[model samples]
Target: MKGLYLALAALLVAVNCEAKEPPTQVVYRFDDHRSLELKGWDCDGELWYTDTQKGIHSQVWSQFYRIFTKKFIHPSERYMAISSWGGGFTVSKDYGKTWSGAHYSPGENEPNGDNRPPYDDILSFTVVGDQGFLQTKHRLYMSSKPFDDPRILPGGPGIHYELEDGVKGDIQSGSAGWAWGLIYMTRQGLKGTIQELQTSWKDLPDKTPEVKGYTGWDHMRCDMDLGK
Candidate 1:
């Protein structure tokens, strides 16, 4: 009986030690000059500001394990936006006090439009004022009002895709603005361009001007001010 009690005590000690292990930490920098470091442990999650002296804060959502990127229109903590690794988008207007639903489905058919599924390869999600943009593997979808009534941006599918061979590149959004934009790589070179809200696309002449010897590129990133 003495030996059995000792073994049980040792097992309990091991379990306690395992429980005390630190959570996985990941830092995400956004174009709105916000840097959030997330500490995730199972179903519990915490976020801390890396740029300021603000302390850690908890999140009610449990599925923060694999957030790809986040964006917001202003520097304030309100109206935070994030995209998940499993191709979902979410928004919090009150510093995460409450959250909008995580949108995963493309919903039903549109009036006079073909029935297409919601994008399942969301690489990035961003919001600029009342406008929102979602970048997928092969297309860019935009909503003039919040996250509703999404429609394909004109010339968007071609931005990330090569015009010559129809091959898609690694495309992603960088900043949140009325003129927010995307960066992509092609056989020609790496390029950056912007699209105004409900307007046309324009190229940035100075950004990523050259990629001399590189055949391909991936995981492109910009600074806190969006390479400004």
Candidate 2:
């Protein structure tokens, strides 16, 4: 009888230990020093960021629509952008120090009119230095500053283009050319045009952005511990 009691007590202890395990946080690490930690993803999806090198840790966002959000870091590592199909876009230019966000409606006309592609028509969004490259089906756009208010660049369909990495390529609906902190895409490949196109370009320093830490599109129920 004593052995049976001991066995039941041991089983209860094991169950208690399993129940006390802490929840795992979903973290998106841009590098060894910086990361975005998601605490919750319900109505007020709690979002936080940490810069271990800077000794800064703070909440970034907690909006209603976070279930569909995904984060992206520019090659310059200065601009960290987040996109949610339902919540719009948010960008940080000061290495997660401050943030600006706006919601974009697809198929809707912008202030510039119809020829200009909608902000949400992000077939491929790439950043090189301080410039932002956004490519649609027929045109390649450029933002002198980027992730904020990008303007259309001079170009059309039917020409291939060369990337900064020396890889001559055509327009693709998926990823674009991201090399040496520059991106290029076109239907008909052209060489040296990326440099020839005159714009007030700035040489933003490279910090080697990374995106391998993203877990998935939406946060699972287990990702956050709602209980006290």
Candidate 3:
């Protein structure tokens, strides 16, 4: 009886420790000497980046929503950007040396559209070339110069998409909002500040906007290696 009790205590201790462990994921890897990582789970987490070549390893952002937020990198151009749930963008022009963050107050009502319900959730967020976009249930927000701001482009109707299994579930409904591809299918049509997208829309063979850059973060993997 004594031995059994001891074994049960040990198991409980191990289980508790494991449960307390924070989840981590490698969100991006630019090269052998540079990378980004996300630590913690859900909305409570820190964003960290390491540039061995630049002798930098540190947290860039904190208390971010990991599930809905993401970072984008243009390695060759030394550009790094993040679309945040707090209603803005965080960008680093010189790799990780500098950062500019913009956001609307979470406590405040989000930007709403005509006759549309309040925008409270993020459906999708993406950055292509120099343009950035954030989609909610009823509103589509854009930023042409995401490096400076995430509200450059005009607001309009948000884009709707079917999940892999054709269900759009999320926090309010158990369906999560993952990264989405850029589609020009909106009420705004082919009108935007991003010249590439606007130009591409002009010659689109069909009325449907061509989906582009769906696997944008495929190359950005986050791996945690707390070295000894």
Best-matching candidate per lDDT? 3
Listed in order, each prediction's TM-score against the native is 0.41, 0.43, 0.43
lDDT of 3 by residue, 1-228 (tens): 999999999999889866776776767665577766777754247877788888877666776544333333333325455654443556565666766664432221333423222336555554444444555565444433322111222242233334555665212111211111222133343232132222122332222123353433533443334220
Candidate 2 minimal-lDDT segment of 10 residues? 178-187
Q: What digit string (tens of lDDT, one per residue) describes model 2 on residues 1-228?
A: 999999999999889866763332554555567766655333235666678887767666764435332223345456555544453446566766776663322221233444345445545544445444545555554433343111222243323666678788554322222221122222122224443232222332232223354433322223443433
TM-score of 3: 0.43
Give me the runs in candidate 2 sitting further than 4 Å from their true place: 1-24, 41-44, 65-73, 103-128, 131-142, 146-228
**Model 1 per-residue lDDT tens digits across residues 60-173:** 345444444333222325545554444444556555455554442232222334222244444544444433455445444543233311223333332343444565453334
Q: Which ten residues in a row have the lowest lDDT in candidate 1?
A: 182-191
Clashing pairs in 1: 106-118
Instruction: Rank candidates by lDDT, best first.
Output: 3, 2, 1
TM-score, cand. 2: 0.43
Report the lDDT of model 3 for residue 21.
62
- In order, the Cα lDDT scores of the candidates are 0.39, 0.45, 0.46
